[model samples]
Target: MVLVEDALLLAASAFIVTSFVGLFRVVRGPTMPDRVIAINVVGSNVVIVIALLAAAVGEPGALDIALVYALLNFLLSVAISKFTVERGGVL
Candidate 1:
């Protein structure tokens, strides 16, 4: 049990680090679509991290929060994509 918890924490930490790296693309992407995609990727990484932490801590309530966050992330991506398209940005 201790080993499993440690592994989960390590994996969550890795995802958090990679998400920070992905933020660079959000800042420096040459196109709106590229930035939106990077944002989506970061959001996904966050969702995974939340889920992993929830599992590690044995909190089912946190899983519900993670699921809600994942849904919000999807909606945000869709909304941004629509906005960009309306503004003449290519998909």
Candidate 2:
């Protein structure tokens, strides 16, 4: 179990680092879609980290929250994409 936890932590750390890299794209994006992609990456990382924490701490509520966050992320992404498409060619 300890080994499993260690692996999970390592995986979480890697994802977090990737997320930070994605964060740069959010600020330096050349296009609106690029920024949106970066934001989505961050949201995915959040979901992963939350799930890791829930497992590490044995908190079921955290898992529920993670699930909710994942759903919200997907819904928000779709809404943003639709709005961007409807808008007069990307703000």
In order, the Cα lDDT scores of the candidates are: 0.95, 0.88
Candidate 1 per-residue lDDT over residues 1-91, each given as its tens digit: 9999999999999999999988999999999988999999999999999999999999989999899999999999999999998989894
lDDT of model 1, residue 52: 97
Name the candidate that leads on lDDT. 1
The local lDDT score (0 to 100) that residue 48 gets in candidate 2 is 98
Off by over 4 Å in 1: none
lDDT of 1 at 56: 97
Write the residue-wise lDDT of candidate 2 on 1-91 in tens digits: 9888888888889889999999999999899899888889999999999899788766878998999999998998888888888995476
TM-score of each: 0.97, 0.87
For each of the candidates, the C-alpha root-mean-square deviation to the true structure, in angstroms, is 0.9, 1.8
